[model samples]
Target: MYKSLLVTGVCAGLLAGPAFAQPYGYDDGNDRPEYARVIRTQPVYQSVRVDEPRQECWDEPVSYADPRYQNNVTAGGLIGAIAGGVIGNQFGGGAGRVAATALGAVVGANVGAGAAAANTPYVAHEGYEQRCRVVPNSHVEDRVIGYDVTYRYGGRSYTTRLPYDPGDHIAVDVDVQPRAY
Candidate 1:
């Protein structure tokens, strides 16, 4: 009877001790909170540029001449002949005068032609000309890079940034036990 009583007491004590000891449950409580269901999500964006404006310019040469100076050689010769004829008339008499006149005319004509040809004047006109070409312009705009998530758990609302959208419910682990600090 004594032995049986001792064994019974030992068994009872073991059971009661375990029951009174802190219930073997979860939370060390210092652990971080887990993710809960997402309530609302909004996309985040950033702006960027894809193209730019640039200007390019260059020069071109153009040539032209005075219309009146077109036939310099011919005009000069004619004027020279007329002048020579008058001068010869004043210098010699009869046949001698005629010969002199003829020689003078030939010499004058040759001189005039040479002078006019050598002294032909040309003008160089400089003008400014401008032209413009527009390149099709474009730019890149900010696009959604990620999502801003609002989640609810433990009867509280929380916010976070995520690379992708989490829909509806997010998984969470609960702690039945909390540690005393």
Candidate 2:
């Protein structure tokens, strides 16, 4: 009888040891998996203000005249004076010719200067300049960061925010714990 009682006790202990050593929630009957009906799922959005930098470019026309042609004015006046004096020397006699030559030289110098200014070559340099500025193009965008889920579980309504949509039903963890009064 003592040997039989020892065998029965050993068998009972072996069965109970596994039940006690099991993990807290698995098959322990207190914690299990259940589903909650999703009543409404509203997408939670975040207002994001984005600033995108873009390069906007356009061509601007630029032009300038070369300054090397300015020396022609003096050369033109001297040439005109010599031509005028020769023409005047052929006109009058003696002192009159001298007076005429002086007047003609003066008139020729003035005319030559004027002609040189008008005939100067204007070297125009035409080109385009690319100018740019950083413009802040901003716009507000609504991004769905999460979902506001309203669900009914065990005849009670609860609201929670989830990172993804749970469709019509959401799997929930049901943990039953003794109330501490």
What is the C-alpha lDDT profile of model 2 across 1-181, one tens digit per residue?
9999999999999999977795433335655577889999999999999889887888899986665555687778898898888888888899999999998898888888789988997677898999887777989999999999999987789999999999999987866667999
Candidate 1 wrong stretches, greater than 4 Å:
1-35, 52-136, 172-180
Q: Give, for candidate 2, the lowest lDDT window spanning 10 residues.
A: 22-31
* lDDT at residue 99 of model 1 (Cα atoms): 88
lDDT of 1 at 167: 86
Checking candidate 2 for backbone clashes, the offending pairs are none
lDDT agreement of model 1 with the native: 0.76
| Tens-digit lDDT track of model 1 for 1-181 | 9999999999999989967775333345757545577889999998877677666565555555565455787788878887787787678799989988988888888887777767887554565556556665668899778999898876788888888888886656766645779
Query: After superposition, which runs of candidate 2 have C-alpha atoms over 4 Å from their true positions?
Result: 1-32, 64-122
The prediction achieving the highest TM-score against the true structure is 2
Sequence-dependent TM-score of model 1? 0.33
